[model samples]
Target: MAARVVSPTGRGFLLLDSHPAGCFRSVTDMVAQIPPKAGSQDRKVALVIGSSAGYGLAATLAGLVRHGIDGVGVAFERPPGRRTGTAGWYRTIATAAVAEEAGSDFTFLNADAFADTTKDEVLDLLEKRFGKLDLLVYSVAAPRRTDPRSGTTYQSVIKPLGAAHTTRTLEFDADGTPALRDVTATPAGEDEAADTVRVMGGEDWSRWVTALADRGLLREGFRTVALSYIGSSLTSAIYRDGTIGAAKVHLERTAEELDERLRPIGGRALTSVNGAAVTQASTAIPGIALYVSVLHAVLGDALQSPVEQSVQLWEQLTGAAPLDLDEQGRLRLDRWELDPAVQAAVAERWRAITPETIAEVADVAWFRAQFRGLYGFDVPGVDYSEPIDPDLDWPAPR
Candidate 1:
């Protein structure tokens, strides 16, 4: 389709252009005015991969709103469907609009992060446009990948550790009632785990940095970070201790390697161990909803939400004395993972609470509403009376 301007209903602008180059440039210009940090690097630029939604989008928004970063976001997903507001899309538009009103600079690149061509295109653009980037956030998560070298496609599957087991879980539609659901764990072979490593692991991260650095697209003393999670032991068998855990181990290792690679330029690769939040990716995992439900009940009592964790993450990246390790010298965020008090509390609650007691113990109602909100199912202020246009433009950029 020929490039045409579409005014977003609430805030930003959308170009209904099929050509990736023009679309990318337009979005980049829209958000390019964000101010740079004082007494630091001059002309700092950030590139956020997987910036369409989730943690990536959150980080991008925080960079602009909280840190005064002028940067570009590379997203892979389409804009929200009419009435179905994707939170990440909404946040992006809102952020861009605010940045524009404040005369900040920001940009958006919508493309597949896994494609080598996409990487090269981004690097070229960075070279031509920003010249160098001071920060890079790698947050792309894909279920499958086609190996460029071997031409082999690999798909990742989520399964519990050990044998098949049936667990009682809450069905949101069933009046918050407990129902027993049969769950099976697929035993992934070593090759399968290796393939998962090849796909979702850190190789792509290394490639992007190497390409950007070789092109002189990275500024000296720059920092690159990727977000990872290690949930509690109850779910570790399926996450950190399972097949996915294997992949994460490889990813952590890659971060160490990248750290060394970036050392010469004073660039550093950091891996942030983040707390759990609701996302399209997290919902499909086994037993996560229930755990999140319990967490909401316990944490919400203190008026804390998952967004608090996100804010903490942003502070760590941009703060004057950003969060460092605990007494043990490991990352405090990871220490937050292994905190004895937090672990004890969660484990005790997990054992004490059942599906029947879920509504009573945890804020099942709140969690359900939040889950629905993720998919634009149950937002409070949104008007459902009007017919939602699935293609409604996001109101963000001016």
Candidate 2:
């Protein structure tokens, strides 16, 4: 099949079409950056839910290339058909390719991870192929989920719990010029808050872990990490103190519960607060784009990319580096972004930010490029003028 050039198409932060070649290149670049294990012959088995893009994808790639871990990844992604596939679809294929190169047994399941059937399928696969799993990474970020038993659907909302939250946000025009505008996110209703908790909270993580343990698919030292975020005060109203924050609180609590339950088996469950990045999920949040831009401006070289954070996280998990946990017993990978000096600088910039001065106050260009790159656009070394074949197929799951 011949390849065709795919242009970027989207309104606001929601991208419409994704470039397959660019997605492949992006995953390849991430895989290349992970340093291999030094004379260590570790053969860990893992299952990473939502392991197609963002932090999930980075962690999957790091495990395969850095430690040669055999694993299975579950992600809900659209395959290439009438239009191009999702960026995550391409990234999954690219990750499987990396696994092949590293000689690790890896499987990618394209199915709804929130479903009971998917859980059963993954548990069966683990029992048959890779045996007991040493790690489970929960990084799902779907907008909605259907309760497998109750038959009720829950949709998540990004709104404050109390009164309305008005904040300065970043927006881009059609010509790619940046603008700072005030965005008011009204409070979520009681039903919306509960539904958001249902969809985004730790219930599913607990379910997965419980099912795996029941099926005897978890090893004695099994550890599960769920990705989470608690942003700076600038985004607290819409993020850390919002509907999503409520769900996160539930997730953290679930981790504690699971940690206690798994103690007899020498297992542990904990949440890892990851650094901010330009992901499809993050861009939709009210002030995340502006906050991330200012974060880049202030932290510069100190800022950890998703891949860097994943690499460090793996090191901590495998005992190569010291585990840094916050007082709440959650991994603190966002330490750099949450630094006192960095937050002070970000606060100053947030106060002085305006449409005219945003470019100078924040890394607007970098943010724009990062956003575009999420949909496989504006990627370095990609031949935009050349044609790309969007109809790509994922390798058969191992």
Candidate 3:
């Protein structure tokens, strides 16, 4: 495999190494080695939407590596930069290459997931390529959309609530010391909230399932899962308790509708309340960086790396029985959010540590490194000194 570069019209270059095959083999071997839980189901084909980065990308790769799931990914964004490529792109290519090396199948579709046309295209491609899909993961998080039915264009914003709140955050350089920062609550108006719902919520999910089911493309006993988060009360006012929360509620409801529709096919729809991790999506929310940084410090050795979380999600999706559900019957991987003991500890720590005392309490070193790693900044093994191609083509693996 010669080195290649893929450059998208609006996006930057993505770098591909001469060893795509080798990268793929590494991923496949990793997955093949994960011990399956007792009575785990045999792995099958899977489809992952919003599979470019963050949790979605992790989940998809994990499915391949941990559960032996061979599948395709439909991503909205291409790799960043033509030569350098985003971390997600590297992961996707690596995943596909490894699956192929393992005598399995993989594909990467670059398109907007919200559009009906995109969904149809995916279905057609799946029908022609893999025939049926056993698991479908929805992990898209778009901020704006034009409602085709209503002809309304919706945009979302992140703002604080009520009076402006001055909060302390971790300075990237200083780590544990709380940097005094003021965050104004910019509540989204009714229209904005509705638009957020339109773009980020359940409506599109329901549509995708409906269309796929109607086409008879889903396998029997299949599972469809979406990711959701309900953070702590500290940040819930901006996340689960605010405009985004409203959208998530709508998403949950959409899950219910999806469950009913999939019933006849012996399929199910579920939403997982995932544990919080550092991702581009999480960073934009007010106060999350501090909370995550703090949590990372506490978890220190105990925390599941993004790779570990991906493994957990794969187990849930491909495990023998259904995933462990919360009181609401939704899948719960709230490692940080649901642990009462941990939450109490973190809240207490948050209150006690201020700008003046942060350095003494938190692990600034770990937090900054992790933050940089989120954007492919500080990966340990990648060769940053080498010249990278700015043009790479990453079409689905044929």
Candidate 4:
């Protein structure tokens, strides 16, 4: 018997192209798009926890190129069976390569952000080299975490409370047609919720902040932010009101405490409520893919990617505009995603969705394309037909 091969799947095992040019080209192009500003260069150094890809990578790159801030990133990713790991690994390598060409620091440590070992590494690096960090961005999306202090690992679950929640899930067929499957996830247990909170909640984020403060590695006026999402009412049952939502609520509360802790030093902690998109993490959710499908169709060109969203957040932070927050206190960056017109239009498509209308009403083609792009399959200017050595020689900063 030979080792089993893992291939792409729209709903099943989603395959990713090993093409390197697409991943590198996509980010370098975006970095060159931003013109440097005079005062933006004031932010000298930043630490991005969980900065492998998605919003974290975009934010790190945006900070480095757009604002001239050098970066240190933390992530834990290993290659698949015989292939390179998630696209993030390659993305980080590509980002570091770009930064190298520009002669900027783009250090990376492949270790669990929740572990004391990784924190110790950050402390040493900051003390020996950068001295202090002007910004800290926490964007880890993990299903499990081990307490650095207690050494006990916790796993998070996504399940409804009280009763089983049944919802529609979207998967693409071999011919790339959208197929709907009814999925009814079991209700979460009481202890499971606690574990979910323990893993996905703000403990690690708060820990990172306090550790930096303790080590005096945080610069004056340092700012830290974490990401969150509260989508429309359609996903409340599985998202904002579910077990993961409980963790987010705790995460928001922790941000309040962190804000208070940093206020005296002129630093601030914020949780940015973002829009939904296809990600390795979001695909596990029962209804988010379907929601995003309908959302993309309704919003059309108005939809923004993680990079665009991170750029918006960066703009808001560095600008003179007063900080805006919802009644619940998290920063509102999903206004377009949750716009009344967008949601209403999405709802109409949601109700109209059926096996036959998946292509017409929901834009399944667009959905599948985006998913493929996440792993470097659908990007332009890349020749995928050629063989690729997934073993990219990433610079080991550790």
Candidate 5:
């Protein structure tokens, strides 16, 4: 197989194809950054739902390398057939390869996590192999979900709740240069808000926890974290104060309820407010790409990757670092991203940026590169001209 170059199919952050080798290399590079720990005499087990990409993948890698824990990851990914596999599929393969190298037992299930049948499959696997779970990470990010019982499909939107919001965002011009553009998201209707909550909210997280408990799959001192983000006021109207925010509020409230419910076995549930990164989901938000690009310019080296944040989260979970909880009792892993100085700097840049000056004011190139990297393009060491096979397969889960 000759090296195949895969370009995104659509404009504005829509990637329809992925590169197999590049995705593997990117995941391996991330895994290499985490120093592997010696396997414990009695290794623990963790389950990461939606563990194919973004923060979920970071958390799974952290558990395997930094904490020496066996892990089970559940994700929906496209297998290689007429085209290359989804980026998450290759990344999962890389994760499993890393696990084998580190001598940690790992399993990857390619299935829809929101379905009850998937839940049953996971429960059976846990009971048969691991017996109990030490950690459960909920990191699903999808555009829509079908209710397992009702069979009703709920689709989420990114609009604000009340009035329309207009913000400056980035879009590529015909010449392929990052150009500034005004993007607007009208207010979400009541149904839209409700659907967003139903799709992206905490109901799925709650369901997973309930299923685990009912099956006696939760170990003593078990911990569960659902990844979250609370951006600054710059993106509040379209993000933090938008329909997605409403869903996040429900998620946080659900965390509180689950925390209380888990008190019997010393188990705990909390939401980890993670820092921003170039995720597949973030690419679709109206103003988030612009905001994050400016943030990268202002913060520079201080900006944390998803893996870095996950490492800190693991440290906090294991008592190696302090758990900085906000008044809402949610773990604050996004503290640095939300620091006053950082926001002020980002705001100043945001105000000065324009269609003509966006390239200079924000790190648009960095943003573009990172976005491309998500689908295994524009990576550092991967040679695009080299021949490689797109049709590849990884070992199936045991």
Candidate 6:
């Protein structure tokens, strides 16, 4: 395959390398530049669930850069190819190389995070190598999960809370023309809330922590984290108040429980509600592109990428910042995403957006660029049209 070029299709889908090597460059550059705090000693080891890309990957990099922590990362991804070799895969490959060159202990485990088999392997690896883990970051997001204990599979649904929701979804025409269409989400069925919770909620996280505890894998002063989101009113019905919202609520509660459980060990658990950003996970969610772009436009330099948030989250964990908790006892890292002034401006933009006037109202141009960056496109210093050995695969994990 001569460097098969891919672009976002009508429904925001694509299967092409947007400069795979550029993906490596961006993540590698970000991770390498992370500096340790003043007079702060580096930690020993870390673990990141869902670590292949996005927040997990950023957290993994941040852990290594800022705290000089070696890490074990867990994620499931398809292998490298014209079809399967993706940004996350390339990012992981880049990470392994950096770790190796730096003589740092980094292991990338390609496996299902929800499976007991994976947990067992991680336990064994931790005991053999690091002996214990100081940090555990869970950033897994999926449409489906199979229960490791009961062997039940659950598919998560995005829907409205009470009534059906009709919203404008931004998409491109079959001919690649940007357009807007109405996307209506029906109310959830009786089992959907529970099912979404089962698949996307904190059950897996709780299981991981508890399993680690049972195996004595959690070190003293251990820390663990999971990601969550609470968008503004525009996205509330389909997100913050819907099936996924129920799951997040449960996840927050699970954080409290984990905190209590880790108290004796002088460890802590936290659910960091992150800001909205262009990620594989968020892009797959319906009816949010316009908001994200507009948020970027209005927030400007205030918009923080996963790397920025990851560093901030790790800072508090390492006592680099005063811990700020909301009334619910949760970390509100989405402070900028939900800023009253920013929200007002975004709402104005949202009300003014249309197929014809979208370019004027929202920053789709910037959003599109960020979308390309997700797949390793829109990156400098790479030739996209260059061919490669089609049989190329990720570097072996050490």
Q: What C-alpha lDDT values do all the predictions have? A: 0.62, 0.91, 0.68, 0.79, 0.88, 0.80
Separately for all candidates shown, the number of backbone clashes (residues 3 or more apart, or on different chains) is: 17, 5, 25, 5, 4, 0
Best by TM-score: 2
Q: 1-398 in candidate 4: lDDT tens per residue?
A: 12233245434635643345556766776576554644534556788898776678778777766666676888887754455566777778887876676567769887889998899988888878788888888998898998967888898999987788999889877877679989998999999999999998999999889889999988888888899888989888988889999999999999999999998889889999988877777877888888988998888877877777777777766653456688877888799898898899999999998888877888777877777777777776777665555656666773
lDDT of 1 by residue, 150-208 (tens): 77787876654455434434455434344434465666667777777787788888888
Against the true structure, candidate 6 reaches a TM-score of 0.93
Name the TM-score of candidate 5. 0.96
Ranking by lDDT: 2, 5, 6, 4, 3, 1
Q: What local lDDT does model 5 show for residue 22? A: 76
TM-score of each: 0.81, 0.98, 0.85, 0.93, 0.96, 0.93
- lDDT string for model 5 (256-351, tens) is 999999999998899999988989999899888999999999988789988888888887776567878999899998989999988999989999
lDDT of 6: 0.80
Q: Estimate candidate 4's alpha-carbon lDDT, on a 0 to 1 scale.
A: 0.79
Best candidate (score: lDDT): 2
Candidate 3: stretches off by over 4 Å? 1-41, 79-85, 148-151, 160-166, 173-178, 335-337
**Which of the two candidates, 2 or 6, achieves a greater lDDT against the reference?**
2
- The reply for model 5, stretches above 4 Å from the true place, is 1-5, 38-42
Decreasing TM-score order of the candidates: 2, 5, 6, 4, 3, 1
Better of 1 and 5 by TM-score: 5
